[model samples]
Target: MRDQDVEPFFATLQAANPSPETELEYTSVFELLAAVLLSAQATDAGVNKATRRLFPVAGTPQAILDLGLERLEESIRTIGLYRTKARNLLATCRILVDQHGGEVPRTRDALEALPGVGRKTANVVLNVAFGEATMAVDTHIFRVSNRTGLAPGKDPLEVEHKLLERVPAKYLHDAHHWLILHGRYVCVARLPQCWRCAVRAYCDYEPKTPPPGDRAG
Candidate 1:
């Protein structure tokens, strides 16, 4: 999408849902960090469901460390890669308590240095917790950006860069949430709901999905 189309695009999305937030639930930076780590390859609802019980008693590094790996495994066992996630969580917590004063580090290097915290995880923390304008290109954002011609790119990193450059400053903070939600509900992977899409007219996707038996030449 061009610079001129940026305003109306976000305006329409924002009007629909005035306040979009990450589905992941957490009380503090530590809980948010831990939640994002466990959320890899998992749904926000699932992560929230598991963390809801876990955070009350053991949200911080020291608290989670006290709970031990076995208990942590039990808490998040329902999520995919639970075993691996459990190990990473324990190790990361230990490092945080020992090295970072049990706080979520602000810099990407420090955040990524923690076990299980990759670019995407760090990006989410940076944006949601620190109010950074960074975009974390997940499967949902990836599809929506490319499909809608908002910021097409070959890979997640490229897409993120393009979005940062293309997205207007006013809407930069919530762009990730908007795009992800749009993909999850409207511009879906298998069959985009073109008819109901808010920015359907602005999209550059040619030969857009048509209604059944409504093919065009």
Candidate 2:
């Protein structure tokens, strides 16, 4: 996509939803971090379902650490890879309590050092929790960026960097949320809903898919 089209493309998305936010439910940075950690290979709805029960019981690092591993596993067992995620969360909580005084670190290096946190998780925490202008290129964003020719790249990191470089600075803070929501709801992997896309005019995807009823029988 040309530099000129980038701003309007994002402007269209911004206009449709003035304030985009992560679907994952959380009241604190630690909770958000843990939710994102558990969200790997899981849906936001699923994570929220589990956390809805889990958070009220133990929302903080210290509280979660006090919850113990066995109970924590049981709490989040509804999520995929719950055992692994539980273990990572426990270790992460320990680190938060020991190293950071039960606080979620703001720095990328410190955040990534947590057991379950990765680059994407760190980026999400940085952007949403701290209001940093960072992109967390999940599968949804990855697909949207490439399919729309917004920032085509072979991998998430490449797409992330390209998006940061290409997206208008004014929209950088919420760009990830907009792109991820668009990909999840509109530019889906199986069949993009190009017929009703807000930015369809700017998209470079060829032979855009028509609505289901419009398809040939």
Candidate 3:
């Protein structure tokens, strides 16, 4: 949490995974945008499963628009809130075709204007697709930020802002990915795997969780 510890904390993460990436599968910015939109309240694995089939059939804004609402719904029905997601995707495709010339807009305002796209989704697209140093504080990032005393805040926006301010500029671009992956695999909500954490030495959390078999008898 200290000014100095922040750098090494992220350095440790970066060392472990040199190139962190979003688990959501996509080949284009448009597909990534749609995948992030559908990923709300859903797992990356689930989204990938649905998108795997959906993308091949309708990967682009125009292709998805041509797929029609009924068929789109059927294609992504395996994901949670598929009906709503389908409707939003359809509307978003229309906007992309009409306003953005079938391209995923790079600006935050334009990206957020799309149906189903929120600040978090926009941040992800901006960071991953455009290499912008933005943080998309999802449940995983939120939990990791607070639990590790990295950038404790009451809400995602606060955490995001704090992370941007606190994290060293050199690590800003990949900070979100590193923290998200760490939270997803190590600093889990139910029980953080502190025993094997790479940055455990820098973490301010008290009474770190022990290895499974090392629990007090």
Q: Per-candidate RMSD vs. true structure?
A: 2.1, 0.7, 0.8
lDDT of 2 at 138: 98
Each candidate structure's TM-score, on Cα atoms with residue i matched to residue i, is: 0.94, 0.98, 0.98
Model 1 spans > 4 angstroms off: 211-217
Q: What is the per-residue lDDT of model 2 for residues 20-97, given as tens digits with 9 covering 90 to 100?
A: 999999999888999999999999999999999999999999999899999999999999999999999999999999
Q: Sorted on TM-score, highest at the top, how do the candidates line up?
A: 2, 3, 1
lDDT of 1 at 164: 92
Off by over 4 Å in 3: none
TM-score attained by model 3: 0.98
